[model samples]
Target: MTDTTQPNTATDARPPAAPRRRRRGGAKTSPDARVAPPPQPGARPPRKPSPVLERLFALYPRLFGARFVPLKLGVYEDLLARHPEDFSPEELKLAMGQHARSTRYLESVAAGHPRHDLDGNAVAPVAPEHVHHAILELHRRRHPRTPADAQAGLNARLVARVARAIEASGLPHHDYAARVRSRDASANAVVDEALITLAAQAAKREALLRAFEASGRGEPEFAEMYGIPLDEVRRSLQQARAARTPAT
Candidate 1:
């Protein structure tokens, strides 16, 4: 009865709270919201370790550990099915991509390691083309500082690399040529030169073998007559014999 005659001064002294203003679209703006500036053109994105990669390392230490191995083709499907609860398809795909492009993985491929599955079982051999490309990429990475004037030496190294890969493949000239054709004209030219060098080497070895067989002289005598090192003659003969032997 005492307050009914007059306004409650405590409530009247307090101002009402301000209403939140809405935008043109009726969406309320947040005071703490911020807009990030757009990324600069030609700027590289920052690199950081991915969370999925860490999880992969925890699960498959053998493949994703300090020592990496070449993974079998289509390993993405296996990973997706095996770890459905832990990872999404997109996350796993990106993680696998990062792993494959890593230097250690490329090294394994270049070294001609057999492709391995999740269980570390060798499923199939790495293709010759894959090995060739890996070697080329690794070479570029390792020789990033090579000067333009040293191009001849660089090309020689490239030819050597291609030749080594071709030899390791154990494929005939025509077969390797057919399998390794690509849009890279310079690489193709290098491969052509490497093949020619290999053919020349084979011809020389065959001639040496024929000469040794015709001379009927022992290893030392034949080497002395041809002015070649006995070890070299022996190696050449051994290689020729292996080449002639039909694969069983």
Candidate 2:
């Protein structure tokens, strides 16, 4: 009877599991789950040239055509001398163009050619470096004192010369000299003011040195005279004394 009346064990056995939903690309489902990929490293950016640099590039051929090859070469040589580390062939080319323009302008002015004007006067352009050299020469002649004094004097003379050239060439005097005079006056005032400040500093230093010397302490008067801080002076004196003292 037990065998004949057995419960429906076939239906009780777990019904067949539902089929898994497939991905759109029919890829197999990973048992552990998938992770998003990491981002790749960014690429290095390109270096940009300056506007002045671009202008120089444009000017090179124009300058070369004007029979200023020697002048351009000299300019490159000077640039290389001044900035050996930074100077490159491209940079040299730019510098030479600038120099050529400057030299040309100077030559034109000297030869009685018209100064630069908005009007079509065919004014010759000068190189900035050449003008700088000429200005320096003038400054040296006018002021035989310090380099700073010579530079100031030269700058003044340059402005005056530019004004005169403009007038002689029938070009509008751009009041360049007047502007320079104003700037020079301001600079001279600053120099005068700085002299007073420097004198005060010098007096303070002298007084400090004198005090240190009179104290007869281990401190150095030179440090005080040179306006070094008390802590630094003390440290320097200690080191010096230690250096001079014989090792036990």
lDDT of 2 by residue, 1-248 (tens): 46756556877566879998887986976967677555557955544644544553454443333432223224556546655665576766775455544544345434442233222233444433333334434444554667566455334444445434433333222332332233454334433443344445445545654556677765545556667776876654554444345557
Off by over 4 Å in 1: 1-46, 144-154, 220-232, 242-248
| Candidate 1 lDDT trough over 10 residues, lowest sum | 145-154
Please name the candidate that would achieve the greatest TM-score relative to the true structure. Answer: 1
Model 2 stretches with alpha carbons more than 4 Å out: 1-74, 77-183, 220-248
| Candidate 2 steric clashes | 7
User: Distance from true position, residue 27, model 2, in Å?
Assistant: 38
Over 149-221, each residue of candidate 1 has an lDDT whose tens digit, in order, gives 4454437877887888898899887788888888976667778989988888888999999989999899999
- Model 2 earns a TM-score of 0.25
lDDT of each: 0.86, 0.46
